[model samples]
Target: MADLTTTLCGIRMANPLVLASGVLGTTRAILTRAARAGAGAVTMKSISLEPRDGHPNPTILTFEAGVINAVGYSNPGVEEALAEFADLGDVPSPVIASVVGRNAEEFARVAERMARLPVAAIELPLSCPHTPGYGTLAGQSTPEATREITRAVRAVTAKPIFVKVSPNAQALGEIAAAAEQAGASAITAVNSMGPGMVINIEARRPVLAFKMGGVTGAALRPVALRCVYDIYRTVRIPVIGTGGVATGRHAIEMLMAGATAVGVGSAVAGGGVEVFARIAAEMAEWMDRNGVARVEELIGAAHR
Candidate 1:
């Protein structure tokens, strides 16, 4: 069997397949199932300082190739998350706690609370572009503010921290370098794009209750790949590649382009949990068939 194992920021994942934060990863049961199903690791649903019920009405919808969502970062509060995390047993694999906060204090506080848990990593959900203050901080169009928030979160936890960025920003290289300097162990580029909106022609009204939603799927692959490729060269930290990964071949492409690992979110919504297992198993088989003895060998192997 091919060695599908890969290490990111010092954490060794069973495989590169990861369950990205959102509806599928919100609970321990779901996370445990993902782990069992063969995800190398799982990122918890985005948790915030205070509980948010999120925008009402239709928040999720099927777009042509992937999905458009404006879930509005709804989640149980950190206190409650900590409570739920305490009950997990037989955790199938490493866990990444996804946390979001309004400002530095919330980030620090959430990081500290999660530090007490058994999580292998912490993913700062700084992406939801449609939200007000909280969403933009991670991909803060400005490097200074991004650096400030990263610095604050860094001080509190020694666990590996991955800063998930929004694609809306114009300067990816600058901001990625800033995040690395501010103490992020790794960078996950690029989060969903657009505050793209859809309308119900019949109602002559907007579809989502939030009106605007982030765009994700195959359409985002090029943008995400470019961000990872650029950031990989600009910074010494690892890059968790994402955006439109729906097949084993897509996973290999991201790996070759310098992603130490890749995140699978939107595809799971369409492909189902079996998709996780399929990707891992298929990747392993592809590695062997392609004469790749190890997946790590593919990292940064892109010729141009």
Candidate 2:
């Protein structure tokens, strides 16, 4: 079998497949289950300073195009999350604590708290489309805002910082480059795209509770690939390419597009946690069949 191990910013992964934030990542049991299921790592759902119930019912919709959701970044707050993290003792895979904040100082506070956990690194969800006054607002508004958040978080933690940026950004490359300049250790390119809407023709209403949600799954693969390609060229840090990865081929494509790791979210919604091992198996099989010796050989291969 082809070797699947890869390293990002000094942390080593058994494979490149990471169970992306969201999608069954809310609790410690589920997160640990994913790691036990063969995920090289798992990112917890975004946590904030206070608990949030998020939007009402019908926050998610699934159709032929893909899954669209406005889950509103619901979470039990950082203190509760810290408790959850503390309960998960000796999980086999690395855990990346995903943090969301309304401002730079809040981001720093959360980062400091998460740094006390057993996590391997911290990930900042800078581009969540459904949540207002956070995520994309703090991320895509300006490169300066992105830089400030990154700097503050970096200052508080010795753990590697991974800033997840949005594909909806006006200056995607500039924002990514700014995060790099501000001391980010890695970049997770392209969160869900758009407050794209779907309507209930009979009810004459929006399908989602929020009226709009971020599009995910296969439909987002192309856009995410392009975002990773652009950010990869703009920044030297490792990139976690994520958006619509559903299969092994898609993971390979992301790596070829310059991802040091691949984040699988929507696919898990379909295949459950086993998607992590499945994707890894598929990637290794493909590499062996293609005469490739290891997964790292494919990283940025398409850039040429």
Candidate 3:
């Protein structure tokens, strides 16, 4: 059988399929469920220093190409998250804690707290496009901001930091390189793109209460692949390609594009948590048929 096992910053994974942040990662039970459902690793939803109500009702909308969500970083706060994920020993797969903040100080503070947990790593999502005080809207997408935030967090914890960058940034490669220089262990390339909107048409207004949200699913794969390819060339650190991955072929494409691992989020809405196992199995089958011996062999194949 083709070997699917891989490592990201020294953390071993049974496969490369990771459950992306913000999709069914709100609770420990769901995280564990995803792990048991076949996810090689699971990331919790973005947690903040304080609780947020998030956007009102119409936070999520589904279109033909993908999903658009402006959940507004709603979470019970880091305190609650600490309580929720305090014990991860029961989870079969490694847990990655995703943290968000309005600035480098907040990001560092939150990282300091979450680092105390037994998580496999800490993911800094500096790319969310929908929220006002966080992510791209807050100016966290720039190379300078990426460096400052990554450096601040690095000073507080020894845990591996995975900086998640925005797909919308034109200087995507530079931003990733900045993170690598600031002590980031890996780069999670391309968060959802566009705070794009969908109109209700009949109602004559936008569907989401926030009016705009990040785009994900099939529509984002190409852009994500390109971002990963660019970042892979710009930085020596591993890149976790995240955007619109849905199937085995997409996973393979991401690997060839230089992703050390693949992240799945919007697809879970359609395929359920079991999508992880399905994609991994499909990847194994494709590798077997193509005579690819191991998953690692495919990483950066396009660059070669």
Candidate 4:
């Protein structure tokens, strides 16, 4: 077997495959199941300071291309999350808590609460396109504000922090650098793009209840790869590459683009959690064919 183990911001992973911040990240059982299935690490769904109902139904729409969603950061507030966090130590794989907030104080408060848990790290989704006041408004609105939020979180936690940014933001490189300067240990690039919509031709109206939602799937790969590659050059910390990874080949591309770990999301809606094992196996096969002895050796190979 190939040595598939990798590290992100000092947290060791059995393999580079991470169950992205959404998907089956809600409860302890589902998260542990994903780990047993093959995920090296699991990121809990983005949580907030208070419980949110999220947007109405039809928040997600499926099409031939991929998935468009405006789930609106639905999560059971930090206080309620304590129950789930209690089971963290028993999980087979390391758990990373993903958090979102309306302002710097809220972001800090959430991180402070999560810091009490045994989480490997805290990820800030600073750039979610569909969410109005939380991610998009705080991140893309200004790099300085994003920096401040990160700084606030940094002030409260000794655990590693990862900042996940959106592609819709301007000066992505600068925004990433700002987070790093504010004490982020790593960066996850390119959250879904566009609050795009599909119209019901007969109904002559939008399909999704939210009207527009972030686009995720095969269409986002190239754009996300570029974002990771650019951020890799801008910051010294590791980058967690996520966008439309559906195969081991996609994972390899992210590593070459300087991602320390690759995130698996939308693919789950198709291949199920087994997609993690499939991708890992595919990656090993590719390595064998290329005579690559270690997975880490492939990181940033494209740049060299």
Candidate 5:
């Protein structure tokens, strides 16, 4: 049999499949359920210093290619998150906390508080495309912003930090490299693409209440793969390839693109948490059939 176990910044996982943030990671129960369902690791939804109501209804819309969402950064805030995830003794897989803020100070403060918990790592989503006063809309996608935010968080937590970047940034590789240089332990390449829009045609307005949202699903895979590939070549840190991964073959393609682990988000909406087990099994089967004894061997195979 082929080994699916892998490690990210010293945190070991039974498989390379991770439950991406903001999918079904709304509560501790869901996070635990994802682990029990076969996710090797799980990330909580992005939390801010204060609770947010998020956008109005119709925040999410599904199209033929993928789902576009302007759900905003809705969360119970860090205090509630701390209480919810306080005890991880029962949770089987490692938990990664995803933090977001309006600025470097807020990011650092949130990271400081979240790091006090037992999470295995800290992830900063500095690339959310649809949110105002945060992410790309706030010009946080620049390499300078990446480095500053990463450095701020680094000062507060000794825990490993993973900088989540955007696909829309032209200097995506440079942004990844900046994060690495500023003390990030890993890179989560490519947050959902576009604050894209869909129109009802009949209503003639827009589909989402917010009128725009970040894009995810099959439409994002190729762009995400390319982002991961570029980041890998630019930095020595591990890259968590996120966006549109749905099947074992897609996972394999991400691994070859230089992802230390693959992130699964929108696929869960269609396949449920069981998707993790199915993808892992498929990965193992493919590995065995190809005579690859270890999952690590597949990482960056394309570059080789």
Candidate 6:
């Protein structure tokens, strides 16, 4: 059998696939189901410093490439998430907590709260695009702010910190470098592009309550691959790729682009957690055929 296991930030997962933080990871039942379905790990639905009901109705729309979301980083504050986090009961290999906040202090607060939770890592979402002026704290757009927030969180928590980035920023390289300087253990790039909006012709109105939001789906794979490849070259720390990954080939592409692991978010939204089982089979089969003995060996192996 091929060695699919790859160590990330000192944590060993059964495979390289991780369930991205979002709807599928919010509830106890959903996370439990994903864990059982062979997802190497699962991230929470993004906890914040304070609870937010999120934007009003019509926050998501379906398109050919992916779904546009204006969910607005809604979550039940760190306290409630802590309760849900503790109930996970060790079913998954290591539960990864996804946390987000507006400023550096807020990020630090969320990190400290999650530090008490039963999680192996904290994926800081400092780059949520739909949230207007906020959310881009770690996205490589604002190097100074990214370093400040990352350094603050690193000072408080020992858990692995994975800083996520936004696609809209052209200064992603500087942002990643700053995070490394501030102490981020890994990086996940290209959160969602556009913060796009679709209008209802008859209504002459926006589809989402927030008017615009992040887009994620099959359409975003190429952009995501580029972000991963770029960051992989720019930094020594592992790059955790995410975006429009839906198949075994896409997952393999991310690995070849220098991603230590890939997070399947939109695909999970489209096909359910069973996608993990399917993709795992396909990847393993492809690996066996090529005599690829280990998954980590595939990193940055693009057609050279």
lDDT of 1 by residue, 1-304 (tens): 8998889888889898777788487888989988898888888888887889887869888777678888888888898999888765667888899888888788889888977888999987666777766776344555776788789989998888898887777877888888889999998887888878889899999999888888888878888888888888999898899888988989998988889898898887778888888887788888889899998899989934
Candidate number that wins on TM-score, 5 or 6: 5
Count clashing residue pairs in model 1.
0
Clashing pairs in 4: none
Pairs of residues clashing in candidate 1: none
Candidate 4 — which residues are off by over 4 angstroms? 138-141
**Ten contiguous residues minimizing lDDT sum, candidate 5:** 57-66
Displacement of residue 245 (Cα, Å) in model 6 is 0.4
lDDT of 1: 0.83
Cα lDDT tens digits, model 3, 1-304, are 9999999999999999889999989999999999999898899999999999999979987789889999999999999989999999889999999999999999999999999999999999999999999999999999999999999999999989999998899999889989999999999987999979999889999989998999998888899999999999999999999988989999999999999989999999889888999999999999999999999999999989
Candidate 4, 122-218: lDDT as tens digits: 9998888777787785454357877999999999998999989888777898899899899999998868888789999999999888889989888
Q: What's the true lDDT of residue 31 in model 4?
A: 93
Location of the lowest summed lDDT over 10 successive residues in candidate 1? 133-142
What TM-score, computed on C-alpha atoms, does each candidate reach? 0.96, 0.97, 0.99, 0.98, 0.99, 0.95
Write down the lDDT of every candidate, Cα atoms only: 0.83, 0.88, 0.93, 0.88, 0.94, 0.83
Task: Write candidate 5's Cα lDDT for 37-140 as tens digits.
Answer: 99999999999999999999898878898889999999999999999989887789999999999999999999999999999999999999988999999999
- Runs in model 1 with CA error above 4 Å? 137-139
Q: Could you give the C-alpha RMSD of every candidate to the true structure, in order shown? A: 1.5, 1.1, 0.7, 1.1, 0.7, 1.7
Clashing residue pairs in candidate 2 (N, C-alpha, C atoms within 3 angstroms): none
Winner on TM-score (1 vs 3): 3
Scored by Cα lDDT, where does model 6 land?
0.83
* True-vs-predicted CA distance for residue 122, candidate 6, Å: 0.9
